[model samples]
Target: MRIAMWSGPRNLSTAMMYSFGARADFTAMDEPFYAAYLKATGLDHPMRDAVLAAQEQDPALVPLGFVQDGTRHLYMKHMAQHMIDGFPLDWAEDCVNIHLIRHPARVIASYAEKREAPRLADIGFDRQLMLFERLGGLVTDSADIRADPEGMLRRLCAAIDLPFDPAMLHWPAGPRAEDGVWAPHWYGAIHRSTGFAGPEGELPELKGAEAEVLEAAMPYYERLFAERLKNS
Candidate 1:
């Protein structure tokens, strides 16, 4: 099985990758498309050079052959907002698609803490909205999985027609081959965790310009997510 898990920033995407990679029979890959994206667009994303360098060193990190043989299961983590160049969607037919979402407020707060400059609204909600609209049946909410990791895992497995293995719930501490080379900088906290931590409450007030940006993004997010729910 080939699975592509899509998500917005700060939506526990890395953690979900950790969960899937825990399975002994599964081989997982991180955001391989990112490096190609940065290279192709010349966009000065955070840690842009490092991402390109990593892909240069490991061609496997870039999309090449499908996991058509040895690996019983293969997984890829994706940032939904980053599907701008149409790379991942081009390969959507090659894998089962999964979308993960979080509240715009919390997502903004998390990204703000990391000093990320782009907000959801800045990324063009209509673009993301269209992605989800096109990939409707493939979407799944992170909050739903957070509410019941085990149950949700089973459901997800079923959705993609894979058996639910307990091993999918935990992974050995530390990095794996497919982890983004920038993991040390961006995924420090997730690297320390072993398994899913149930959903938590929203962060406190996100004041200033960031707060305003999040507020502006909320309605568009609501529309997209609501449409996703209705379709799902």
Candidate 2:
């Protein structure tokens, strides 16, 4: 089973990767395009060097190739925004694509906490919303996963035609193949976690400039997200 998990920043994408990686038979890759993307575009993304290093050191090359051959079960995690540069959509026709979403306010809050002056404007939420709308049925809303990881995973498995496995609910402590490259900081919570914990505290409050940016982006995203939810 080949699977691509698409999500925005701070949307539990890495956690989902951990969940999938917990499975004995599954091989997982984290944002494989990220290193190449930064290198190609010359964008000064945070932790760019580390991301490039991970790409250099990643040992899943052959496994990923096999997965692409429509053989083994593989999971690739990606950020929706990264699709802007024309990622190869046709590469995974036999693969299941899962879209992970969180409330924009919360996503912005998380991004702000992790980066310097992060804003919905900076990430181009409008463009992401448009791309997501275009993808339509290929996307899976992950907001409910916060309340019910196992149930949601089961549903996701069913959607992708895989048997639900309990092992996916509990990952071992520490990293698998996709860690240490951007670890110690980018993967702090997920690296230490064993399973999904229910949505925990209130999302950090947005204020001043950040608040303005989010407010500007909300109406458009809300409409797009609503459409996705209604159709899904």
lDDT leader: 1
Worst 10 residues of 1 by lDDT: 56-65
**Cα lDDT, all candidates:** 0.70, 0.67
Query: What is the Cα-based lDDT of residue 208 in candidate 1?
Result: 82
lDDT of 1: 0.70
Q: What is the C-alpha RMSD of each candidate to the true structure, in Å?
A: 3.5, 3.9
lDDT of 2 by residue, 90-196 (tens): 55455565566666777777777777666554455665566555554444455677677777788777766788899988887777766537666677777778888
lDDT of 1 by residue, 85-158 (tens): 54546566656777676777777767766656565533445455666667654556667777778887887777
Q: Please list the residue runs of candidate 1 whose C-alpha ends up more than 4 Å from where it truly belongs after superposition.
A: 56-62, 68-71, 86-88, 121-127, 227-232
Query: What's the true lDDT of residue 226 in model 1?
Result: 69
